[model samples]
Target: MATNKPQTSRQQKHLAVLIDADNAPAAIVEGLFEEIAKYGIASVKRIYGDWTQPNLGGWKKVLLDHSIQPMQQFAYTKGKNATDSSLIIDAMDLLYTRRFDGFCLVSSDSDFTRLAVRLREEGLTVYGFGEQKTPKPFVSACDKFIYTEILRADAVEPAPEPATAPVNGASQEAKPATAPVKAQKVPVDFIAKVLDDIADDEDDWVQLGAVGSNISKLSPAFDPRLYGFKKLSELIKAQPKRFELEARGSNTTGGKDLYVRNRKPGK
Candidate 1:
């Protein structure tokens, strides 16, 4: 029997999904692409790991099916893991070439926390995907942090059941737990921590562009989809209670620009 499925609309934007096979769960590999396809076209798909290892045997099928190039990292040192470094080096090379619009870093290790930061320094969008156990340093580093568990759950049940209420007119009540509400306040503390961490390493007023840069650098798996916001600006605006916005002079082209800064809750 023929089945109808929603057409996957092609996106104009281009993205790359870089997987650290050592640290990322193989089960979510398909789900990861499904999620990335929502943002843009996956023009590039690469996964880094020691392919010689028996653990990576499972990824071979996926690599062929998805046309993802497998980057093999041999053990360079006894105890030191080389996969993270190799991935970072390759990512830097890709960044300098200016090939892709965004990158998807699929790994659960904190070692990639800095790689994400570096990519953003060059002004590239990053999306991070990892398990819930991913360290705070790594979790906070990305533009967005997506727990793979959530995606796994979503895969099992794509959507929630509609709320049902009693047909009787005697003060029927709807479930409050399922109701949608306005955006939650952007965590000022979290934003401040991110700004401070990046600024401390490089002393400066922290360009608004740079803030975005740092976010992507910290987490290539971060996408605004996790927060139910289409764009970053709308997410910030939704949290006016925590963030303050400002208009700055235009660039050389004379286009108006706005900036976001973290402030005290009341200010």
Candidate 2:
């Protein structure tokens, strides 16, 4: 897994994390924090559920270790989840505070679809974490949605090939681990659509960062991991036949910016 890029104080995002214990598994807690670290600091981490229920008993120790606050909501009625309401209410309260730059909603339930959309409407970025079974509505509602299944990569993803030195300009990056979900078939058409939508034929050299941002907007659940790569640049680089990668000294701070262009025929 790639680590979070170093960010200045201004670039760092303060995020409020809200997890639906009823819908998420306890096993993902470790990987969840690691993944969340990539986006921003967890200013507030809270999980919601009925603590009295034995079904959520597995989460007890995990919460203490992560220092995550547990918000309790009783089962007001059979077959009804009051926890959802509790989480939504608390989320709005946090939103109004205007302290967080984003919200991390961890749940596999589709019920939070409106909640995600509402948060984005308030100009707050919403990052969703859920299982693959999560509905399209919920996934599309967030700014970015990560499937929890990838969090448990070791057990699910096949071992990667040995690493070699990276190439300059057009990177021949090391291959990522094979996914059990078979998402390795690169999203060629999707990439083409995003390129066409963002860059015209004359604008061949589009910054990779801008391309990535648009990809998230068009497909919130689109992740490089799904295509068996750790980063978008690598995913694009892997497709030498379809795309051309360029690295421009790009930043004053000595960071190179990667650029992409659709591979022209016979070149």
Candidate 3:
């Protein structure tokens, strides 16, 4: 009997990336663009801020290097954030154009929470990037939220050198080095629950891809990188006690399919 094949390739999405220069750091721009490329082609890249102010001076070189168009919104009052309003208006204008499949809203402010929700309601995916302190509502509203700290360049630590030999013909024992700290652990229980909820009952196994999708839906900021793993499969495999993985042959695609299931109790 011929087996049915599943579609594995994703359609490239067109995205409009809008940045709030006031709330985001200039250092993350390179990493931000690199991260955005993983999802789709950025057809429109724009940043909003009051260009005349000295505070936004840092963004000048970054904008030129990335070719991102700057949309100036002068502060009309003493303490009002006019940039948010301008960005929201432009986002709506772009939404009406029906040209983009998604929007990347770069800001840590909760002001964009409603905008994200509204965009998703209209069938547009929203990818949010912000600091760890970003509001939960804004993070949850996005389809996927990336912590800018992770996107920034990692600090390099120099490796310890080999111990030197003593001149008295007696070799000294090398001092034991302290182990490096581990990355924060992901919520495995929550992840397993999500997988179980979406798994097929026949075998209690879920497609790896499906599980990844559901996890993102449940927690927009759920990323494998948080656990120091480069990919979701790697992260899952690292937790052998919590899950089981199997690789099956694909019928139509001539590739292997990965299936996963939560480990049985006491197994």
lDDT of 3 by residue, 1-267 (tens): 977774333237889999999999887888899899989889999999999999988798789899899998999998998999999999999999999999999999999999999999999989999987999999999999998867773321224345687878887865532222235667898988998798768779888999999999989999777667778898899899999999998846798889899998898
Q: Model 2, residue 236: displacement in angstroms?
A: 1.0
Model 1, span 102-203: residue lDDT tens? 778888899988988887777777778888688888777677667775565442222355666667656657644223323333454656667667654322
Tens digits of per-residue lDDT for model 2 on 1-267?
A: 988977545238899999999999887888899888988899999999999989998799788899999999998999999999999999999999999999999999999999999999999999999999999999999999998878856333434535566667677754442224445577888897788778855867788889998989899998888777888898899899999999987597788988898888899
Number of residue pairs clashing in candidate 3, backbone atoms closer than 3 angstroms, sequence gap of 3 or more or interchain: 0
Overlapping backbone residue pairs in candidate 2 total: 0
Q: What's model 2's lDDT at 138?
A: 98
Please give the RMSD of candidate 2 to the true structure.
Answer: 9.7
Structure candidate 3, residue pairs in collision:
none
Q: What clash pairs does model 2 have?
A: none
User: What TM-scores do the predictions have?
Assistant: 0.57, 0.85, 0.84
Worst 10-residue lDDT window, candidate 2? 174-183
Residue-level lDDT for 192 in candidate 2: 76
Ranking by TM-score: 2, 3, 1
